[model samples]
Target: MSWKLQSVYMGMTDVATHNVLLLLKSVMRQCANIELNEGGNLLQHSLWVAYQAQAAGCESPLVVAALFHDIGHCLCAGDPELPDYYRDREHAALAATWLSRWFPASVCAPVAMHIDAKRYLATVDPAYRMQLGRGSKQSLENQGGLMTEHELSAFSSHRQHEQALLVRVFDDAPYVGECLPPYTRYERIVRSVMR
Candidate 1:
């Protein structure tokens, strides 16, 4: 692993937090080279959700969470196989943990629990399940289907539960967005939030 990443895993110094304004610029720059299946763009999707959070006046941390929520996809990029991320339920956790190195739990927790938020929504809202795209559906199956009673109860009481659910709402948005402004636009937010 790269020294930076290894340091992070070893609980070294890192910071991962910021606001929506900078989100637009940073995400555009960050995601410019990123793309996903179909016509989806990872940064586009992330920015869309982050923008939504911003438009709704969500907290800066949540906006940042929305912006990098699926970073795991990039982290696991180029795997010829399905990757072991799913077998261990590490998809969101991977992103969250990595971000945790640089960010506080306020930001990482929502990213970490986004998938569980999906499962939570599917279990509580039948229409939500029906609306899930094929990929999401497959992932849900891979994520152990709907939340069991115990899982649901535990999730509902989580410290970041509300924020995580909000992140999911943004995550489900269609993958389409314009390039962000500029990284400097919100650099202060990131600097202030970093550990």
Candidate 2:
């Protein structure tokens, strides 16, 4: 049951939920082959984040956001024509845009803002910048360095700001060690959140 975005956008609501879930599974499987800088693949990273969110008592939307936050990395990496910096900066927004059609703003907004949340954390917490992995540090630079005070203030006003920060925290912690339920364990949880 592979799904394409074109078919999804063509009023295929009847199967959209199932198809979207299938697409997520497909992407997670694809992530196994793509190495992340944190010493694991995107699938592991996503699962780690999802598990951390659930452990923290985050709501379903936030957990879903955590799982899919880095999916943009897989999506953007597929385009050979795009530069690395473009891929780094655009992945979050790309994931968010695609997700918005199927998910509520609660889910999509954090996915969209997670990158900014990274930048925001760097601004507010001096120790946070040093905690970023090598790739994340590079992407942080590519993402306009740390957010300025004004930018941070504006970002804080978003309704999902706290959830975005929590997702960011989970995103940062996965590099420490392999932990929690396996990747497949999240399939049911993710599917439950699909509209």
Provide the RMSD of all predictions against the true structure, rounded to 1 decimal.
7.6, 5.6
Q: Please report how far candidate 1 places residue 87 from its true position, in Å.
A: 8.8
Off by over 4 Å in 2: 1-14, 176-179
Error of model 1, residue 86, in angstroms: 2.9
Candidate 2 per-residue lDDT over residues 121-185, each given as its tens digit: 99888898887778888999998898888998899999899999999989888455655687678
Q: Each prediction's Cα lDDT score?
A: 0.75, 0.84
Tens-digit lDDT string for candidate 1 (1-195): 998889886563232233443443543565556666546567666667777887799988887888778877666555557654463266688788877877899999999999899999999999999999887788888877899999999999999999999999887877454565433544555566666
Residue 45, model 1: lDDT of 69
Best by lDDT: 2
